[model samples]
Target: MYKSTLALAVAVGVLAQQANAAGFVEDSKLSLSSRTMYFDNDNRDVKRDARGRNGDNRESGQGFKLDYISGFTEGVVGFGIDAQALWGIHLDGGKGHHPDNSSFIPSDTDGSAVSQWGRFGANAKARFSKTEAHFGSALAPNLPILVSNDGRLLPQTFEGGTIQSKEIDSLTLNAGQFTHAMGRASSNRTGLSVAGGTQDSNKFQFAGGDWKVSKDLTLQYYYSNLEDFYKQHFLGLVHVLPIADDQSFKTDLRYFDSSSDGKNGEAGYQFSNNGGYAKNTGEIDNKTWSAMFTYTLGGHAFLLGHQQIGDDGGFVWLNQGSVVDDNGRNEGAGGASFYLFTDSMINQFARAGENTTFGQYSYDFARLGVPGLKTSISYLRGDDIRNKSGDGSYNEWERDARIDYVIQEGTFKGLGTSLRHGVYRGSGEAGADMDQTRLIFNYTYSFM
Candidate 1:
């Protein structure tokens, strides 16, 4: 015990010295969250066989997270570390309350909750000039060909290394290779790949760049390839058009094209035929695009957005799915916050048929009275899901809402809380219609 205490003290002293010299230090924060998820199928009477293995279900759960970010070293090349610890407990729901298809929470063979589970990981990073690189066991990632799945109770994490650079003007470059993954509700690390793909080749590679042409215009390009899986490319543009003295409209455009590669590449897959699982051999071509605009007036912001997917195949890939939370910036989170366009449903252009559309509206309560508070509501509907053999088409729709708050001042300054709700319905497909809600509360205490 004395040795442990001494070690901790020495570690703290080193962190303090580093923080003072390099503007970085070892810091910690914690958050608590709760979620009440419900799954119901409106078309249950249509076909009992379509209910999947889990049938229809509803359940409630609670989660916790502890995070630490270390300060960089005082030198020409600074070094630092990031660590996260997480756990979740089942508050409600049992075997009968959960869909057999959803593994949001693990269970015993007898259909009872496994009680609880926990996970921990750390990443080491080095920075020089405008570039930084980190490698370790953490969030698997979210890219074009290997996007992680967060539709369950937790976000997934991966083991890998990533590098980013922005030394030249407005151009930013990113590259990485991931080797393994851990699900949001799991602690053990496993080989990386799609949900039903082979685990033999554990490496997934990606690289990309983003360039800013003007103050209001930007361009982006990225490429990702999953070994024995698929390859994807993304192109995007963002422009802010000045409308009037205090009004401007922002437009976000994105496109993705993907196909099988290597052993899983177009010709390779087709040649082997059943060599790949899920009858997913051969190649797939697909694209997804979105455009949005936001106008602000007297603290009131109105936003409208639309997205479409060209039905060529299922959605593209990024990385294997996991439960570790991530943002547009690729930083990990344990609570309920997520990046834009990463909906629980309609992800990866999975909606069947041929086309999809979604719209959203948001407001800042600060204009009304509460400063540090915001809310948003959105709706999405997708159709034309082309089933194999071209027999029929499937459709889906979702209604989602979010509310968040942060402390403005006082001793509790910087504390934050959030709530998210989503209602999803699907028909003419093998998927289910369901409702889900997430509640998260977070507090960060910085020891400067």
Candidate 2:
């Protein structure tokens, strides 16, 4: 905590030195965003916890985020800073409804929900030509190798230094190294690690880039290494074809190759293989590929995709599930997200020897005279999922639907509302059957 505070102080001192610069204060922006959410999860298989209660969770919470972004100082080498403050208030849900392993809310010492929590972060940045560098604890990266998770009240953050360069025409390069992560539901930061690994790894390095070859085609490649955990490489291609004035077809292909690194598979550095079969238990050795195609006409979109997991092992990504506090309590870093269409609302249909097929349909109500409304529904089914026992395979499926609307005109013109629900079922070693729902209200006020 002191380190973060010192970093922020240094950044502020630097910014104060250039407070009178032409573009620094004139182009700064400040905004506050508010979100109220209600979440419900029902486990159909109903397993008893230590307290002998069913595995069902329901909660409501309110979150507020304040952001300040400053424009770069006027110079050949510009300097700036970005800061954020986040606060979460638990509105409802008692011990009976709060599971011990829940990642939606922080837990108290007595295994109950905490009344409230909050955190603050800042980023010190510099820009030279088309290249930019940022170092801070508020980094939320959206890359093919690492995606910051914001599925809950607050967003997950990383403590890292990153650089991006777009000096070359039609190309962008990115590289970064992160040491710690702040979970969405907690105020504390923990070192990085993967699922089923009890020990933490302080180093995660990645480098990647995107190259736009033409008006409608792009290619991407990235490499990531988690110290003592695993190393992964990613390749992606995207293309779009116009069919008519209001119609187009898009194609996206992604592939990943992962292997064990350092002491992976050692005592405290084991991988879970996503709770499925691993050719060698606790080892990372896998190859996965996916393809997605979409057709759009008017206000309607149809999407279809297929994904295959290699028989060697399951997919892998940066996860902090095993990072705990000194008292052995969870630090709320259990949940993470990867870059894949299989990353659905309920389950990530990724496991060894699994094949998944998914589809989605969406519509923009603007075509029917309602400019602020839209809806989408999707379904995914996975089969041939290798069981841990290696005797046979299992199958699972999930269906999700959501609707969103934003007030277009009025005092609450920018207010938005969303409702989403998902149902998941599976057999064999797959996870428990469950149904989940979420309702959210969001609004942002700018104080530029």
Candidate 3:
């Protein structure tokens, strides 16, 4: 299916390209980016222990990628192609750096770190009358229902086709279907699934739109389904109030409803609700909601948020089996992300009956004569997380800090660096307490 999809995509683009050859090669762009990352997680006493989790898991790696984009041919229906090549290198990861759990670096067959790994992909695109369609194997989608994970050395990629249309002003529509995913930690492509189950689902479909009611108000709704795992619907609202020329207030709201699908309740496909409450045992059933308010003025921004998960079950999203390890070949149990304010550096507080309160303060140092520098601090506390005892619950909290800087001038104008640290503590079923730190370096250059 993956090969066939790419073949068809190329055929369509080539046929369309023959109609209009103007500006096709003259407007092409090529770019290269390099990223160096260091990750450390120290797990403290808590509860359950998975197969590859350890008291301390640390690794360092580097990634280099090259991208090429061809301009659309001039015609009623323009055509283009985007290609990507990624390479990952292991810098430092000692023994016990198992491939099953290490996200930033790929492990070898003997549970050791591989010296290097790489993958390649391409995307074919066509444009017509203010609308475009993209088909092929390299897609990163940012929608209310699902968000691609890019927290590690490399970003995840999906194999499928997506379309976006803007037939009417102030309104945009999107739809797509993905059949496979290549995890950040693994080089091979695999089917999709969720936590607690190793079964792979071959289909993931989604459609949504954002409507701008007015200049300051917008509404969004998206629906997503991962075959045999679950189906989810998302709703969002955003409004901004201009208090003055330099200050403003913003309100953002999000909600999700999820339910079971085919094979969800089968023996090997049954879910455990992620160690949280569920209306029906070993099934997917959940509702989640969150609201956030942010105030920005000059160089400072303050944010406050609250989130809650229904007692029926924990919120669910995509996970390509990155958790399971069969000797070392990738079978896809990887991580993923959803649209939520609490998906911080260390935790995602989406368990059943969990109520979380969070806040953040950020500042740009440019106001202090330090350009291209910024810092932020955030904290989250979650409680009343449903436990097996039904009436009883557990509690957890996390604190995070981050600093980032990008060279704005001189020989390294685009060089960027970032540092992040997180401290997490939890009681009850939330699992082990841990401390995590990440350091990153990035630089990108473009040529035409």
lDDT of each: 0.59, 0.91, 0.83
Q: Can you give the lDDT of residue 269 in candidate 3? A: 75
Name the regions of candidate 3 deviating beyond 4 angstroms: 2-20, 46-55, 95-100, 322-325, 328-333
Tens digits of per-residue lDDT, candidate 2, 1-448, equal: 4776687788789889998898888999999999999989999997787787686879999999999999999999999999999999999995588876768888788778889999988899999999999999899999999999988899899998999999999999999999888999899888888889888898999999999999899999999999999999999999999999989999999999999999999999999988998989999999999999999999999999999999988899998748666657676677899999999888998899989999999999999999999999999999999988763479999999999999999899899999999999999678899999999999999999
The C-alpha RMSD of each candidate to the native structure, in angstroms, is 7.2, 1.3, 2.5
Candidate 2 displacement at residue 267 in angstroms: 1.2
Tell me the tens digit of each residue's lDDT in model 1 across 10-118.
5445545566564464333333443334323222333344434445445666666566666577688876767777787777774455543335566544445556777
The best candidate in terms of TM-score: 2
Instruction: Compare the candidates by lDDT and give the number of the best one.
Output: 2
For residue 84, give model 3's deviation from the true position in Å. 0.6
Cα error of candidate 1 at position 393, Å: 4.7
* RMSD of model 1 against the true structure: 7.2
Report the lDDT of model 2 for residue 343: 96
Residue 37 of model 1 has an lDDT of: 40
- Model 2: runs farther than 4 Å from truth? 1-8
Query: In model 3, where is the ten-residue run with the lowest total lDDT?
Result: 46-55
Cα-based lDDT at residue 225, candidate 1: 74
